[model samples]
Target: MGNVFDNPSFFSKYMELRSDYNYNDYLEHPAMESLLPPLKGRSVLDLGCGYGAYAMSFMRKGSSSYLGIDSSSHMIEKARTENAGAGISYRVLDLKSLDTLSTVFDVAYSSLVFHYIEDFDALLRNIYAILSDDGVLLFSQMHPLLTASYGYSGYFEGDYFAFSSYQEEGRREGRWFKEKVVSYHRRLSSIMNSLSDSGFIVDRVLEPIPREEDIREFSQLERDLVRPTFLCIRAIKKKSK
Candidate 1:
């Protein structure tokens, strides 16, 4: 999964896509921003923080410190060059090695990265261990409905969309930017249960609806009205009893 983004062609195509107005800007970012807790005086650990895109926003919102970690050295290099600032730093670290992190943070944030991880339970447990009591974990990922179907085809069969294989949770390999990318599919119930098992209290879940203006501007986003493309979650660490 990490190497996919590091591939020169994939990385270039991805950066170009993100640079323009797109779904992340129209739907996902708005939903994520709505779920964010106050960052004033807090420290943040960003898992799979590609290119540190949101690092400066955290600082501008009054976060005392921000650390963005990504598996791609190419991403970390761009982050350091573009998003570098006081109290902001970037590291080349895979999400699977999260247990190695010793510093507790007030907030753990990830965007569109959790689905790539196979062991959801272990990821939640690692995040739980590194968060301060009452710390927040906020993340977004591809909606299960979007990833449930194998081969990533037959999504729109004529007027209706095909959704299946939701009960089976495991690897789902598909093409993105003309390259094969792998991601995991877990039901909404599984996601909630894992968070509970890891001592997190689910606070909010969002399946964002594209704004009317956005839809009017980017006509392609109208498809999202039929089925959501992303899901956002906010959970807090449970205080020890």
Candidate 2:
């Protein structure tokens, strides 16, 4: 297992989990579930599209074309190998720059990606640039409250089951135990502001409450901690001047 925080593409674990793990209970959130039906026949761009799950899923639904880009060449290679399919393309890309392609998509999306970005402003700005006028953008991410989560401060020794004291930033040091990894947490307000400032219209924010069946499927500990794993969003690019 690589450092999941830093390596955007180091999602071998996630890919395996999500590849065939779509359950209505787990997907009770409309944000992720809604992405499919509307995407049939649409040209789509996926940013930080780790392992190409979401993007490839779109193409599987008969999407016209799919282009997936990510910061992790390692993950991109895996995405290319495992998820490549009809009309789908995967490339190694940096969110701060997307010169590899231009405003050629009908819709775009990303899942659990923005939280890792260091520059929210440059990221949204670049995303806004490649979108066709009024093109839709959908995304999901860890809730901003994650900044206050235990593991962030290195206060926990292991995935909420451990312990530590976060008296200072010095707590962030011990990740060498794994391979490549990097990430940054951002506030929800700041994310919304960045999207707005970058010329997009917010459609809705999806903060889902898991269902009873979900509780039944999760372990007691997971049920308690799985409070909410994702923040789904829908937005549209402002028409070009």
Candidate 3:
């Protein structure tokens, strides 16, 4: 559950998938687009911003300043090497190392990352403390029921939930490794409860229906199991009473 960056394949895949979408400005752009409304004219912190794709999108949306933090060097390398622009920067950081970031942010966003975290409450508090007053936290995670009920991901089908993992042959020779990631498998009520307890007000949650093209491009397994994505979560820090 820790340092998912240890898997080289994930890094390699990160470079390939996200970079392609960043350049294409289409496929992954919607998720990026949905994150922008919260960041307009605000200082932003992008936690687990893989390869800075979402951070780059944030910049294009006119965020005043941006900082991206992730535990993966390979992802950080891709970000700092080519993605930095227009008052945006990337740092290699684990979630627990939140204090290393210098400035409080107006918006903090993450995508497809938090489900891997073992302790969601601690992470949420860390994120909440780092934000400025009324700061919004926008995140997209693997849908718990979707991943739990489905088998594979990526090719969009909006079919069902899936949360399974197994080992494939490694690219490099060595001891076989384990992929031990686990999800919270929560309903919408459970998700809301966690945020409410963490001092956040759940502002909105949107589940997007996939387009017809998504079902066609994907394999049958993806079509069968990949249910609609519980796509966006926008939560605002509780204002002081």
Name the top TM-score candidate.
1
> What is the per-residue lDDT of model 1 for residues 1-241, given as tens digits with 9 covering 90 to 100?
3479899998998999889988899999999999999999999999999999999999999999999999999999999999999999988998899988889999999999999899999999899989999999999998988878777732322333767899999999877777788889999889989999889999999999988988999987898989898999999999962
lDDT of model 1 at residue 208?
A: 94
Arranged by lDDT with the best first, the candidates are 1, 3, 2
lDDT per model vs. reference: 0.90, 0.64, 0.65
lDDT tens digits by residue: candidate 3, 1-241:
3564657865565456554433123222465455455556899888887778666767777899988889887788878877878798888888777866667899888877776565677888888888888998888775554544322333243323333421221111111123333444455565678899989988877655545666465433233234444456888899752
- Candidate 1: the clashing residue pairs are none
lDDT of each residue in 1-241, candidate 2, tens digit only: 2326334433554454455534323643355766533776688888887667666567777789998888777778878888877798888777767755665787878877776666777777777777778888888875554433334433112465332342221112233224333455565676788788889888878766655665566543243345445678888898963
Ranking by TM-score: 1, 3, 2
State TM-scores per candidate: 0.96, 0.75, 0.76
Q: Give Cα distance to truth, residue 59, candidate 1, Å.
A: 0.2
Stretches of model 1 off by over 4 angstroms after superposition: 153-160
Which run of 10 residues does model 2 get worst, by summed lDDT? 167-176
Give Cα distance to truth, residue 163, candidate 3, Å.
Answer: 7.9
